[model samples]
Target: MSPLQKIGAFGAALAVSFGAAYGVGALVGPFDSGSKSEAKQSAHQGAGHQEADAESETEGAASPVVPAGLQVTEGGYSLDLATTALVADRAGEVRFTVRGKDGAPVTSYRVEHEKELHLIVASRDLTEYRHLHPTRAADGTWSAPVTLEEAGSYRVFADFTPAGAAKNLTLGSDLTVTGAYAARQAPEPVREVTVDGYTVRLDGELVAGKGSELGFTVSRAGRPVALEPYLGANGHLVALRTGDLAYLHVHPHDDKAGATKVAFTADVPSTGSYRLFLDFKADGKVRTAAFTAGTDQHAHG
Candidate 1:
């Protein structure tokens, strides 16, 4: 089945909103190993998926802006993956370049979150995730060292902004790992999870199509622990949809330099299960806490 077919009508609407949020023309297929040209053409072909009447609706929390990491190319820029496959359980370098509409490597980029680009890798099953900062070379090619513990299909996202662009863009592609593959189920929803002797509890709810503020407190031994800054904020969050792994744009709110609790705001496009990954620094070391959350459809203001 095609990607749009799998997403169904409701998902297609959300996908349309995602493309529109960035002022793009169409929504492309999910992560695949297809060529960039093929994917771009497929996306334009699907542009008619959106109904003419839906255009009048306000593009706010009601529409739910589902941004980036779904298409390899968007808004005149494309993610060119030089390394598409990697070996399982082995450390290797992944290389790629950002090409503009003029078909030349884009070397100049605006720095955001203390880095020019942020790379995210997650398994198709949403079970494995990683956040890496890649170094850009003089030729505009970005390279990063990564190791995949398991063999499976993974989605690679390049989140960055070209010089003079209005906003950041996330381009996604597929990476294959050769070996025996076994899929794992997403964990059940939980309000609290423990990681590395720290207990992280999630407060607030995720309501679909509404801007939700999520608060997370880090504690150990029944006492709140102060958290240092990570990526220009007290904490960082990356939430992915359960089935298709749609990457949600999470904005971390700024707080005191070293506060015990950090907050974020995110708008999910639809009602479904999502996996939330929280990255925070404490005791001078960075740690990630993962949790599963679902939207409460009935909770609408």
Candidate 2:
């Protein structure tokens, strides 16, 4: 079995445990021994499960705007992209709406992850950044106004968990800003170092000074492993700067078929190295993969 597969299996087990616990709690709610301590413990356990579910559901509660219901046509959700032209423009408001599986309007929902709906928007070149939440409208749509000063390819991520769901979901799509600007260059390659138990490969090339992508891969026992979902997703990645560990939470690009392969894109603020900790599920357990890489200085035309 590969690392990625292990991650998936671990996630599946966790989901089952959560479901079982939830079922038992619900069943035992009505028929209890009537002991005060037992009752209190039960209540506490119930609340803990709810809190866990909520936390799992809102793991990616930060990013650009994402369309509601982003699953694949077969029943999964997806972030739909309408355009890809990068240009400069004033911070204008963007409109969004959420519809149910049956195409009915959905309104008046709870905030699962952290905020009601976390919206993160950043240029593809990794220069601009904006985090905002859209206001819920009566028509079942969420709308938010934004302003941008640079022009480049941008990605909007919608981080939210539907009410009553156990896990959080993230949807991504591409957007383009139009205007005149200088395209930043990619960074130079830096030495690779290992952390924890997994081997990570880093590509330190930068697209712009502050905007760049770091590539990573995980392996064990000289073989690639399939990574499972840690919190309803393939893997969890957190990036922190060397000085203060300036925190940046990221998710895998997509799901993998086996354990050996995984990938991610990270944005940095300047030409420097950063520490990364990747949490992946494997062998029915969760493990942390770590690595460090320095940034290069190369502008994109």
Candidate 3:
């Protein structure tokens, strides 16, 4: 199964578990309602179930689901390229077509984040990455030419919301790039810092050869505050390797407010210095946090 499939499966399991728990709680509640103790227990149980269901639904609903029957076909919504396999190539072209869920031809799509659909391609090792926006063709195909100077296993993500849909979605696929192999190394430990009167804490170290999860918590006056949505997602994070500004586009785990926090899983190709930019809405205004991260050549520090 693909990584996307794995994520979908996990989400489905969580939803099912939440629903099952609610059903069990409701079934047991009526058995002993006459006793005051039983009534208190039932009330607490019901509230717990409701909260769980709400959270499950919110996460499931926000995720983008790729409908069945969509595939790469001849003259269809397919990616056409000289080589789907790449490695340290200075330049290449990715040509693809877009169709409606019903297989009907689609002419255009609304731009999200200043583009029709933002394409984020990155190596699995977190070394090489690129952010590009493709142009729509007359026939409904979107094409974007890219260039890479680093070698690694790359994944391409299409981030966009279907027209009329209330939420944004991310679709992912993997591509292989060939060249000299270099194992990713670990970076320094996470540290707490302050930015623009806001206290923020980073919770993960950077690694060069593998994906790393970086988490951030935002607080003001020693109390957590809700973070409003910026763009279509709850928060926006961008990472750039200091030398060349290699781009890494990361997404938040959830969108709800109250206690601002966002997590991003990213890969870096080589041991180097990287700059992270985090933007979120707080105090009725957009706030950005900047940090310099370093990845070491050894174990995760």
Candidate 4:
């Protein structure tokens, strides 16, 4: 993720008004791995989850505002990944712990969008994306199946809320997958992308510093395929800047779905290139369709 932004109109009050409070949580030492002392790693497993402010209304949360998925720690919560390196093509476990202000593993989380926590993994170029829900143990460690399968640097994001917090926290860290890395560029903005015989089309442009309307339509063999609610929504959209992997959280306007379409809005902080991953469930399985988009400034005539 890119560096934190400078304060602006949606800076202080807007951030705080969103329901995030700086608690009495103390500043702790850097969390290296999942092996910290029990005093530091096992106490505050968590309180609960809340997504009432996950995204802006037109965008995802309540009102349009700055983007998320950039910082490793915000509001005293940190996403602690056990390791930063992985082997390509090896299906392995990506383990992590959510550390609260007390420097202890958070154990409780209120459900949001039908999940306690949502984990997203994607390569820097936006070529590979995976949406996962990790299983958290009593000790506060969350683990899930992950296989980079390709040599590239990837970003791992933990999106969730802790108990009374009003908004969702999307914290991210980097992972180096070793093999033979071949960097690639994001594709040109397109109306459609295909995967596993499913074709998904993009119906919007990401506008810099503004909330932009976005929509998606899924089809196969040129026929609209009905989409089912996944994680309490017809679709979940993840947007990432091509180079730095700066994250943007997006949510559908509603949970209802048509034969093959789900609509959402996205708030982008700056202009550049982006790769979008849309996740939808149908036919008893969840599938992802990826697309590429550029900000209006870059795509402007």
TM-scores for all predictions: 0.77, 0.40, 0.43, 0.75
**Sort order, TM-score high to low:** 1, 4, 3, 2
Off by over 4 Å in 2: 1-75, 78-87, 186-301
1-301 per-residue lDDT for model 3 (tens digits)? 0112111101221110100000000000001001111111111110001111122235556533222112232122333322467647657766655555667656755444445566656555444445556776777777777776667766665554445543334444556777786766323324555556777676665566555566778888899867775554556665544433344444555556564687655444456666555666676556555555766567432
Q: What number of clashing residue pairs does each candidate have, in the order they appear?
A: 0, 62, 9, 15
Candidate with better TM-score, 2 vs 3: 3
**lDDT score, candidate 3:** 0.47
Which stretches of candidate 1 lie above 4 Å from their native place?
Answer: 1-66
Candidate 2, residues 8-69: lDDT per residue as tens digits? 21122111010000000000000111111111111111110111112222466633322222
Q: Model 3: how far is 45 from its true place, Å?
A: 31
The most accurate candidate by TM-score is: 1
TM-score (C-alpha) between model 3 and the true structure: 0.43
Better of 2 and 4 by lDDT: 4
lDDT (CA) per prediction: 0.64, 0.41, 0.47, 0.61
- Candidate RMSDs in Å, in order, are 11.1, 18.3, 17.2, 11.6
Model 2's alpha-carbon lDDT is 0.41
Q: What overall lDDT, based on C-alpha atoms, would model 1 receive against the true structure?
A: 0.64
